[model samples]
Target chain A: MRSLAILDSTLREGEQFIKTFFTLEQRVMIVRLLDRLGVTFIEVPSPVSSPETREAIEAICALNLRSHVVAHVRCVEADVQAALDTGVYGLNLFFGTSNELRSYSHGRKIEQIAHDAVPLIRRIREAGRYVRFSAEDAFRSDLVDLLTVFDAVVDAGVERIGLPDTVGIATPRQVDRLVSLIANRYPNVGIEFHGHNDTGCAIANTISAFEAGADCLDVTVMGIGERNGIASLSGIISQLYIHYPDLLAAYDLTQLVELDQYVADCLNINIPYNMPITAPSAFTHRAGVHTKAVLRNPHAYEILNPTDFGVVRHVDVGSRFTGRYAVGHRAVSLGLQLTSEEIAQLTQALKERAERGSLNDEEVNTFILAWYEEKGSLVWER
Target chain B: MRSLAILDSTLREGEQFIKTFFTLEQRVMIVRLLDRLGVTFIEVPSPVSSPETREAIEAICALNLRSHVVAHVRCVEADVQAALDTGVYGLNLFFGTSNELRSYSHGRKIEQIAHDAVPLIRRIREAGRYVRFSAEDAFRSDLVDLLTVFDAVVDAGVERIGLPDTVGIATPRQVDRLVSLIANRYPNVGIEFHGHNDTGCAIANTISAFEAGADCLDVTVMGIGERNGIASLSGIISQLYIHYPDLLAAYDLTQLVELDQYVADCLNINIPYNMPITAPSAFTHRAGVHTKAVLRNPHAYEILNPTDFGVVRHVDVGSRFTGRYAVGHRAVSLGLQLTSEEIAQLTQALKERAERGSLNDEEVNTFILAWYEEKGSLVWER
Candidate 1:
């Protein structure tokens, strides 16, 4: 089993969501909830970005939550000083190292970037705060440049060296190879992985990173961040809970759905129906074969228990895709002694009705009751 | 590069969505669009499930589109006959193989399952149609059971053998190992992979399976199947586009968003904001630093170009996360000659207002114009 820690950037990364705007109160609420939920770290936006940002960071730091409050800042003196003023327990200093970002973002050469980042790393370490120096587009940067820059910060006493797939371009294989390369090179330093979801591989890439020996992963609530956002907190948790349940023993697993709900409600966005554990359909069994097997034994078709997440499994027996077995099960559960033939007939009728459109729960019940009392004789009965 | 084929099960699996009930016309429309989108195969529910299902399958087969029509059936002679009657070009036969599913689902031993499946595979092959025998819950099944059943069917002339992570329990490494085991065992038989999204590792697992020599992958549009559906059509495309753009050359990539919208609309669900390529936020850059760099060069922060999916990149400059560079860029685009210092001040003010709540485009313009006129701005004075 791989050791892992969670760092939630719902405040810092989520603030970059197009619809997200965290008030000072909202920031405190989010941080408090995340801390209570057992997130290892809660990252807030750089204090240098705005006065409100600085104040929010300061207030969150003052709350003295069990979770470490991390200030995500740029690799510059002013940003470093601002973060220092926030009294954050940790600092995440980043600079774009990819050629595209180098030319258009800070316009700094590799040597200059390393030279500039080292002092901030030293300053943050001197202040007795855990510090991480990140290459913002590590996946796209020249490998040699990433090694040189990461080495400089590590030598400057940074505890963690960060690799971010800022563009969400890294595949699982690529993430594995890159993290393996870096992890092998810096055996003593902690590795942090920050990935975006541009290619829908953020969660997988994060898992790959951990498998390759990264210690911490950066994620955001509901995956809300710039562009398609970063790895989602719930997504990462769901993956771990399914494949490596022991690693998630420290987390309050039941709070995952509510956490997603809270963030989605705050953002005024609907959770996608396919979102790992929180989506409505995540545990809904509707297909005939699946419904049949799941009814008998949920483990037949479910990898995770919805009850574990404070969610219920819904079996849509009213859908046209439902089978005789499911209909039979539902009828028996409703105290009806329908035979297999009757169940098949009723299932056929319900399926035809479903072909036109969906039937409500009441409608399904009405159909079942009506069929039970109706005068029509089946071919077998005749 | 790996050889791959797409098997879309939107009609079959999507019908299992609690809210999804596609009419014959709707099914036909979906099949046509998928065919046009270069899907290699379209799998529909077995004809044994409902009359409408059979008719839909027949209609799709009659269209003679580029995509082959497949009937997803149970491992029973009756289901095989029903599927054969539908005129589908291919048949996907599945039965539970795991101890959990064996004891609870069909109450069949490995011998009974293999005995029942071999005849069906032979029968389907005799019909001169493509046949695939899948071991449901393959990941959880005892390896010997899977090998015995798969080998029996292969000997019985099944054209393809399927490995389904029925509960989405397999990790990428597990998937790779399993697929490699099967691929190595049956050197002549084609391998198919069907994965569920219960753990959000379906797409990555699919990629891993392909990397391990699986030839065909099962996907559904919007991933709307039972229990959070299967691997999403667009998600897989996004992964391939990111890591193997050459493989997606045959696909009508630009139609991905429309495909997602069509499915989501039909299901009456909002596309989750974090959906890979089609969600509204997929291309919306909100972080000030990201917006600044994205404006200069989109590749600086994006791995996949929005235009490739007929989508546009939106740089949100009014959000609190917006940086000085973004404010200056926006102001310059608006023909305002603000100095860097003034831009910084205005950005800070805007971020504060944003912290209170979001600012509309008009409000943002008003703030900028008012600040320009009322302040003793250095640029204006000059």
Candidate 2:
């Protein structure tokens, strides 16, 4: 279970997020952050596309971060050469294998694909570099065709294989079954799983893959990638830390929010409100009943403690849904003591104001202080 | 499998979204939209919180939509009376049963809670209104404690029992086990599931509950709730439509996008980029390799068709990753024929330009026409 390694592909797959264009400086910063965060591998764009892409890869590699840098390239010979020229630690070679891709993408049959990959695999290995041969749409590809390619690549000296749910078509059950099949067949080889979130199952599918014995999982920060992105790094961490802490022992868990903030700022996209642990409201208790309970004991309503990720808990006390208990707690915190009746009245006043919209802390405090004065509670001071 | 019912809590749970303050008119509009979308039940805020909450409930009930309107209230008699006064078709009574909530929230032990709920259940039943007794933190409650409370409520004439993963602490396996246990024990009772998305498993857990024989599942538009929201209505729909289309045949599936857009606009929040099926990027395919295959067969990259949801597919063709095939296809569509070598050169130029950032359609067309003219491609006219 602890064998799973993280391959942070934020620089590679995240570049595919709609309208995302990371500068060379942004790429270096992201790679440095991810490396310091202790991901095992950092997958970056290949040099095949442009001179700047190659420069970005070369700059990342030159940083000599703790993480091993890898490049994602197609199976074409020119791509392989460009990857080698980057002086990276490893190369991930991918090809379209599903029937739809086979018939239309490269227009290559299974035999032709397998035959073409052997020499590339041999060349990458001969250069004393790490290599992984991946089938682009492994889940949609025929099982026989996938195995044939896997077996051929292994014979040609490749030891790692990637199974990608390229179209995000896989369910968790399917992910588990496919991963277990690959694990059993390639007992000596490492299996990697890459999934997309088209149906909102990417995180679950990645979990299922790990549970079924995949050794590596692909993730992008905030799950940013093409078409709704892939499994999010923080989301995976949130799920695993609670159930499988040992797998993440090497990572600095507290830096999760910092990473999310940095990436969101760099990309100029707001951290989504529903982001698992780092969203502003992830730890906010708003409903009257929930605020009341969470005020009494955070455990009453919270399972993921905000403190674990360097975030503070916020109990909203200025809404129509704000309960008397939350208001009373706020009153006490502000150095005031109110009777039960006063507390109820204050809560009612706040709720009415909130019915029109939300109120800030200052307004809530003002209402409480005015209520105290109106009730003669501040008569001694006057 | 088709026994599952949708209890859309957009008005009830969605109100807990941070800063959400739906006016009476907004609440009525949302209720109308949901009713038109064909949810079996529409759950709304209880009247006990404020006069306006009750007014909102009354206004929705007055609409008399085809779906039943249920008010969510505490098990307290005053709350029950407030819900009853609203003239809602049903009442949902909830009590926190977990040790954390029992001690910190209501300070009632199992027997005390059971003793208190009997009269409220009896009163609701005597009023001839549909009533559901729910355990607020059912997932965290001791199994015996949960069964004890559930049994007491059933004995008190409550026909429906809700199992809420209140803190979002449940896994898929746990949801299945808990649902199966209650399902087997109380075959005559209705089982409803309300899950949260803290660990990003709300939809998965809800689906697991359904698979384990739950009769109903609670959802909010965009999964908006207190903290990271609940299971999204669209996420659940995306999962079910693929596996249980018969269950959702009654719904106007095309209205899903409209509903999401309306709610997002009302709340002034962007629909998250990863929102299942409705996000702008949900059907947008980028990546040169992906565009090529998607052009051949959309199924190669898309499992859910955009047409089904009144959306169109967008093939991103102006990125650094643009392939020659995608560019050449665009050239042909624009009535220009270029040699393979020229297409490759043009693709390279586009990639180089894209390294600075993304290009608009006009920019791409300008580059293509310039290249055609530069290559002296007026041969057809000559």
Model 2 C-alpha lDDT per residue in residues A271-356, reported as the tens digit of each score: 87767888888898998889988988898888877887889999989888899999999999999988898788888888888887
Q: Please tell me which predicted candidate would have the highest TM-score against the true structure.
A: 2
Give a tens-digit lDDT track for model 1, residues B209-310.
Answer: 988989999999877777677788887888888677788889898777877888788877777776788888888888777778888888777777888889
* RMSD of each candidate relative to the true structure: 2.6, 2.3
Q: Name the lDDT value of residue B181 in candidate 1.
A: 89
Pick out the ten consecutive residues of candidate 2 chain B with the lowest summed lDDT: B373-382
Off by over 4 Å in 2: A374-382, B370-382
For every model in order, the TM-score on chain A comes to 0.95, 0.96
Quote the true-contact fraction of every model.
0.77, 0.69
Worst 10 residues of 1 chain B by lDDT: B371-380
Candidate DockQ scores, in order: 0.70, 0.73
lDDT per residue, candidate 1, A1-382, as tens digits?
6667799999988878878877778778888788877998899888877777788788998899999998888887888888888778988889999899999888999999989988878888888999988998998899999988988888899888899988888878899999999999999889999988777778888989999989999999878888778888878888888768898888788878877888888887777776788887788888777778888888888878888888998888787776788888878877899877788788988888887777766788888888886735443476
- The digit string of per-residue lDDT tens for model 2 on B153-218 reads 898888789999988878777888999989999988899999988887788788889989888899
